[model samples]
Target chain A: MLSSSKVKLIQSLNKKKYRQKYNLFVVEGIKNIKEFVFSNFLISNIYTTEPIPFMQEHQYQIISHEELKKISFLKTPHNALALVELPDTLPYSIQGIQIALDSIQDPGNLGTIIRLADWYGIEQIFCSETSVDVYNPKVVQATMGSLARVQVNYTDLKKLLTTSPIPVCTTDMDGENIYTSCLPQEAFLVMGNEGNGISEDIKSISNLKLTIPRFGKKQKTESLNVAISTGIILSEFFSQKEKI
Target chain B: MLSSSKVKLIQSLNKKKYRQKYNLFVVEGIKNIKEFVFSNFLISNIYTTEPIPFMQEHQYQIISHEELKKISFLKTPHNALALVELPDTLPYSIQGIQIALDSIQDPGNLGTIIRLADWYGIEQIFCSETSVDVYNPKVVQATMGSLARVQVNYTDLKKLLTTSPIPVCTTDMDGENIYTSCLPQEAFLVMGNEGNGISEDIKSISNLKLTIPRFGKKQKTESLNVAISTGIILSEFFSQKEKI
Candidate 1:
């Protein structure tokens, strides 16, 4: 049975504060819920309109479609919504081309970046405290199922860069061309905010600065989207790895 | 002054049929409007709350914030909005790397692709007739101002591929690794729909197939987002050109 208090609690999970307070995050859709079910994450509750074959062993409540609509963050509600316990943050020992996001405001951008990072075999991502919450529902939906595989850590970006053992690289306009540059295998590739690029302080501390050269004639395109830039840069880094 | 008739006309533009009937589309934000004003596109009217120094010679009307909210499509409306006449489609002579979008349904994906195309110096994009309208307000807003520089045309996808003189490359799972493949300087890189990917009919006619290899250990990520895939592939294609 769908209760008013349950619906209110589910709706409150949309905000970071509420999600943190409950120590749980919402994952919608049967496919996404299945991912969390199989991952290291723990599922607290599952609400669905129909019986899920894969989730038969888990405790779940069958609710009407109308009830699903009340708690769904999407414009079109998926068949299922699962409240999963937030996984405890594990200490990250970076061993590869880790991504560092500085003040990434858009949830969609952060989500897409995570999905791409998974495709490129990137295991970890470090985000500035100012970046959008990884548990944001819009972000969770956009990541598809990749979020379950990738590890995202939130920390102080400046301190992380300064204390790093390997080289720290930042994407810059006047930096060495990425196509010809000798990219390090082990490094922190820091991506900046959507509007401002990288912060001046972060840029000053970075050991290497690389750029994706533009081929457009008019030179009018202001910049590439942060997520798109991440994908392109990562593709290049991995492609170079294959050559060696 | 904002009239009821003007408000109705602007709101009607949100629909594809209405936009085609009027042969006009909406461009919001002072920066975006400026791009169209300087481009070959004709500006029908401009509505703003503040004086636009660049648009002083152009016909414009000052409207209050409440009135602007009624005419604007954005949740948070920018200072200016302009109606631009849709440019007549130009005959595209396949020259460099042209993009063919097969049944692309998402406006944001199309918009981001268009923006990236502009940055990569891809002058023309051909879309399947079933694809989402390029003039969609959501698409226009997402493109930033790249819509002014990049030309998007809609036509029969299968027919275009069959008639094309150069190689028609399609991104597929079983195709050649894009990192190692010999990419052509002049070819049509066809990106598929958001969900189903390139239609069967369109895929059958393609001369070549390309795939972005996944590095993730789990291989659980079903597929990269179509837009992100496009960016990665395009980056590789362009990077290869610099090597030659």
Candidate 2:
């Protein structure tokens, strides 16, 4: 049986402040929990309706479905849910073609970007302080087990871009066509907010500005979704490198 | 002034059965409603909190915000909402690079695909009976404005593939790499369901099988999101054709 306070604490982790205060976030669904279990992330608690063989004897408590429902954040709660310790944010390290985000606010978009980063072999993602929390449950669920693979660091994006050693690449309306641009093997590709493209400050500092040309007959779409833009751009970079 | 029966009709339009019965669907938010107004779609009614300059004087009824909230589907209702006539499904015509969805269950995915097809200049989409309705409010909202440009038809997959004049291209784990493959200018590109990709029946008939190669070091990711995958594949096709 889940205690009222325990249920409250688990539910509170859905918000960023509480997640940071406790340094804990929830991971639900059997597939996602299994990925976290097998990865380096340390699991603090596990609540489930059935036995999870991989979890330690004392790690997970098999609770009734009624008890599980009380603590689950999902509308239709999966078989299991886990409380995981958030990893300490490591110092920013220069890497091959790192993705930089300037206030990407959507958790779903951030999660899809993280999964795309994992697929294309990009190891690190640098996010502005304003970006949505990577530990947000929506992001964790959207990653589809890739949250265990890709590392995301939240930092002051302007400072990072100013000091970066590699060329800063960003997408824009009138920028160089990505198909024709000589994309570097190692660069920082920056994406921006949903409503706005890359902020002017970031765009000014970006050494290479790329654009995905629109082909529609009427050409009315204002912009692509941040995550979809990331996927198409990464495909170009990866295809150019013959990496994927 | 809004009548109780009118509000009831608008609310009922949320369901597929009611939408089919009335041949109408709701278009909310100023941007999407404007797109429908500018397009060939016939508008049945417009309800708004204030006057819309572009709408005909008699077309929109200025209503109170409280009344607007009563009929709006959005969490925060936008400036306006319109009931639009659903276009009759025209007979499927052979087109340049048509998109075929086996059973894309997510409304958001279908919406994004419609928007992406607009961006790439692909005009027609064919979906199986199991696919979500294009008129789904979430989809209509997600499409932004591209719903005006693309056409979607529900048809039998097995029959469509058998009768297609061009090759049917679909992605798989062990297929030819999309980056190096010669993508045809005019073909039916099939993307599948979210969890279980292109059903076996469709897979057996795919003439050209392509794969988006994974380049991650550990490669733990099972697959890309259907929408993201569609973006990457469409990018390759568009780039190869120089359609932009």
Residue B157 lDDT in candidate 1: 84
Instruction: Give the poorly placed runs of model 1, Cα more than 4 Å off.
Output: none
How much RMSD separates candidate 2 from the native structure?
Answer: 1.6
Candidate 1 colliding pairs:
none
Off by over 4 Å in 2: none
Candidate 1 structure quality by residue, lDDT tens digits, A201-229: 89999998999898889877869999999
| lDDT by residue for model 2 (B1-244), tens | 8999998999998899999999999999777888888888888889888888876678888889998899998999998889999997666578788899999999899999999998887777899999999998998988998888788888898899878999999889999998888788888899999988998999999999999999887856869999999999999887777623
Docking class of 2: medium
Against the true structure, what is every candidate's RMSD? 1.1, 1.6
Worst 10 residues of 2 chain B by lDDT: B235-244
Clashes of 1: 0
